[model samples]
Target: MKYSIRKLALAGVALTLVAAACGDDGGSSTKAGGTTTVATSTGSGTGSSTTVKNTASDTGVTETTIKVAIHGADLSGLVKAGAIKGVPEDASVGNSRRIQYYLDQWNAAGGINGRKFESVQITWDPADPKSYQTSCQKIIDAKVFMVLSAGGGFPPDSTPCITVDGKTQYMGIDAVSAKQFKDQLGNFIGLAPPGSASAKAGMEILAKDATLKTAKVAVLRSDWDFANEAFTEVDKVAKAAGINFVYSDAIKVANLPTADANKNVALTVEKVKASGATSVISMLNFTNFTVFPTEATKAGLTLKYNILEISSGMCTSFSAGQLPPEMNGASCVTHWNNFRLDNTGAKATDTPFEAQCRKDFEATYAAVDSVGKGYPAITKTNPGVPYPGFKDGTGTQLDMDQSYYECNIMNVVKAGITGAGGNLTKKTFQEAIYKVGLFDVAGIAGGKGSLSANKLWLASNVQQVAVTVNPDGFKAGKDANGLYQGKCLSPLACFRTVPNTVTPLTFTLS
Candidate 1:
């Protein structure tokens, strides 16, 4: 099962959307060593004011300011380059979507004890570990009531809260997957995917695979933050299952762009082969996923493959039809299944929840750039359509938009708040975080008594492995791969499952 902070918040989403201009905080606090400047309020609703304090111990002085950390995606940058709609690069979809989803649901359902919930976003550098601590310290300094999906793994930080030993509800992102992060998981009503989500699922997936069960396996992962949690879980699972948990000799690739970087995959395969393993399990950057597939193909060695049993490391690339040929048979599993509108039965069953979810997500995303030609599609030349793009000038082109990786973490946060078993509120959200952990997030009937797995908050549950090959295409039937009739994205006319072909077709049918 996939697990991260299960995050789903950004900035104060509870703030009422006011058409009247909300002015900036003109006053500044000078009590602390540095001046505390209050951020201007953007909404005109009856917004409440809270004092955020700075760490007296860190600065040896008390500052007056509630620092709510937030990520600022320069969406305009991508829009200008015709990459995306003019939505703010860092908008609700990043984190606020979760907060808004929850708050809207709560408000509609009768909020926490009838009180509205508030949220904020804080972005940190995935490369800079200090920012992680700093963001947490800022929250502590602000003396806020609690933290939310304040952090993530792909981004490498989870909810950083004040020492639970000190405060009660220091809650934020629920699950703590990384072993190293376990130290950070003190006392906060937890809201993570299951604590054992990745480790258990990764192992189970590998073990169940008949072709890979007895095969020697190599685990490749980052030595850093969130991704390491899934990597570690997969490693632990692989070891427990008696699979060759080869890593010492396996390559330790970094997210760097260097000449030596290209060699990492060959070295990894060499280590795997040296260990006499037939397969390799990689838990590395999504960006680096191309490494092993390309390198293994070059090495003329192809075997069973499994990657991303933890976080969505390079998994999107797979579904995007971008995995290299070597990964043709490899599988990457996640708890959240891609909700395809084409699945009529599933659409009928989960349509309401999924629709509301998709609607909430898109609306929140559009909130930032409601009038831009970013989403909903925008273009005069409808090369493949009558409408050109989804956005028909009203906002962004949201039409033609198909399924991508849905950060179910948002759903987790939403579930936590809803399942708190109490009314919605900041405090209730904190409780909701833990409630999510204790209860099944998916709320599917006859779901319990299974292996150790957790659910997202919305009562939605899915675990699917996606395999997508990239630019070039190939074919392998069960006759070739045994129990695996692999298909490739081919544009070439080669109907035979020969070796490799370029311009591969989009799909193959028996």
Candidate 2:
């Protein structure tokens, strides 16, 4: 069982990485960033039931409800088990609730094509390999039309499978061997491409800054699927941007914080030092990102610049000041900007669109909280669902990322349904998604979200990248323990588009 769990984690990590890379878009035409008034799509449906909307399609569809599922980790359980600390129990569950909030709003306005959205939460601890199969089986048994967002990685091999009319179908959103499984699993649609856009942004930073570009650069990453793709993408950009890599190495992704893990990071740092590398581009998971940089700083290695790709978990670590001082000047490529960190006063925007998005987000958070706390019946439709404490969220990093994902899910479903015209089915949904071109997410994450034709990735044109600096005078909010958190010293700068190759553009950040 232990060995199987390990194997599943590796596979799960691979698929997650695949989604991140796909988000890279690999296209070159530059589109200016910011919000533009885009039209919304409308759908038609006939429903009688309060929950399920009866659609012509019978699979995972009814007269009133469109059945979907969200599969991921139970963060509340993790907190209780002592597996995690200092993070909100609501981190994952709150994300799920946000989905419900959006659905409730949609239902109030009129559901997609007259069919209300209903989602089942399937959660398990990632540590328990058996839990993967268990949770997946539950999703399969429920016969959901699709699985939207996965809060954490799961082993691909343990995914539940079912058959209808003698045809086999696999339970969803497969990132493992994405291209290989794409045709086979017609129902799978990726939520977001995390690493690809960041890779582009980080490389651009290196290229545009002369003092940093001339200095020796090193690349460090874990031996995982996304890390490999990140390194390759970064290396390609570096070579083209006239920046050269002085040293590079891959370390094992598992068994972290152990002696071997410590040794591996320490060794990687030594290689960076030996090669006279003054800057480092780290493409690693949260553990490796925190561990490697901390070790580098402890070794007394002063770096001119450091760029990192960190997940929401690491964002918590950064807020907690667990990251080394070497990261003080570093820039992170992540999903959303921290309002607390925006020194350019983007939070005080004058645009109605921007203001409305912000207002809606705050309202959504409130709605989700009320629903979680058993306040409004509309919010608490999922009675038995777990709702984590609201005090844990800061509306900066993880919460923002989760909200953006919910927006993505809503956008895609609307587009797919509208494109379906009169009928909604697994086949039509997939086809509509493929045909989705130039989708605008109504200023989500302070940028326009889009999906290109036939692509499984969602791109955020002109997204914001936060810069790390001294946490003085820029405090926004508090953590669960009420510790003051620091903000990014830079404004949420805009980019017209993220290209596959590096393109240097000067960004003025005081």
Candidate 3:
């Protein structure tokens, strides 16, 4: 999950896997920097059914319809202005269409509890903070029961408008901190694991790795709240494992001018090199991650990179020539399944839900392309090819990401609604999520997920992977259309999940 942050030259923030928020235990627990109210119960759940009252008088719920809002950013203007390139003309429309495909399917099959979903699409400018507030106001004005933040765009600060003031149920695919989740009360549910959780899990995994365990490592992060929280968690984990960091610093000029931020990154690289660190664990977002490594290379510094999943879209950037060649072999600890591996025959296997998502996504895009909407179809030159993101070998990797997130998020909404039972309200939805526990999601760890009274985030496992360039093309070979069959684009890089490195994200609470 990568998104644009305020005043950053590039649009890249780490939007990791979605998970629920931390629950209140009526007692406070002290952490590295502060005290947090922790949940007494673990809040783990298995997907199970529980019956509640069938009568409904909830807000935004009528006898026959449940109004919801699909919130997204209209980035076509950015493309037109030449501020951003290589993106679709209208991403919001495509995203909404993809989500609507599922909603239409569900309604056709008879919606949950005799009520069909009626969704309204809300679009805003990503570069404008005022637009976020305005978009929240629009959703409030529409009086929708829930807002599905379909893709990355929403900021944490603007969330309280919808979840707190508007008193609406909100489920997003963006990353959120445990503190942010607690502030949202029970109205917010995120699709990715919290930053704190991912940091703890990623750091612990690196600590146990044979190569990194005793290596002098530098920890780098930005000044954003999520990034800061992640750094704190990493520090805690490193201390517990007795793994000391040779260098640790945060880039604090993110909100300053672009020149200042770049200068800061360069200075940090020099500091890391001076510290005699052999490896760096990057907790920065996608944009900063891009700059940091480039600066390191410029400073004649060589180091191994272990990146957190918060830098979600870095793999695609590396493949697309957006990142420096120095990042070719960086490693990541992530819960996200490598779509390139599954799409190509290199690792030819998909979880049941992943297969279904690919099928539906191809069908949806094929329809859109047939209408000459300019959106490329998921077409392969060969008939036997399973699912491809290119048409004539000229397409962006964002298509794959969009499809994955849309499918997973829609499924999450359905599962939550169905689990909530006949009588539906925000409270019932939250309770149902906790009660149902682990549910099925596509393209995540084994398609298993959960939200509980204690655990707010949903990721169950993480895997160690390294970015590798395929000197030889994909195993399937090139198609007649000149599209690389099994391999990615030239320089052919993709994240390969390491064998036997799949580990559950089990971290002890402080």
Q: Which candidate is the best by lDDT?
A: 3
The alpha-carbon RMSD values of the candidates against the true structure, listed in the order shown, are 13.8, 11.6, 10.1
Kindly list the per-residue Cα lDDT of model 2 for residues 32-94, writing each as its tens digit: 221112234344454332222233353465545677777656656545654444446555565
> What value of lDDT does candidate 1 attain over all alpha carbons?
0.38
**Which regions in candidate 2 have their CA more than 4 angstroms from the true location?**
1-58, 76-85, 108-110, 124-134, 150-191, 194-205, 254-267, 270-276, 308-323, 333-360, 367-402, 433-436, 442-446, 460-466, 470-510
Q: Count backbone clashes in candidate 2.
A: 12
TM-score of each: 0.55, 0.64, 0.76
Tens digit of per-residue lDDT, candidate 1, span 1-510 = 112222212321122111111112122332332221223455985555433232221111122211122322223332344323223344324444445454566656644332344445544433333454455545444444344443233233334333332131333333344342443343333323333354455466557666665676666665445555455556676666666654534244433332244456556766656666667776654444555666666667666777643443234322233345556545554443331211111111333444454455445444433323343322221111111123322232323221212323345445543343222233334444544343332212112212111222222222434453323222332224211123321211111111111111111011
| Superposition error at 487 for model 1 (Å) | 8.5
C-alpha RMSD of candidate 1: 13.8
Worst 10 residues of 2 by lDDT: 14-23
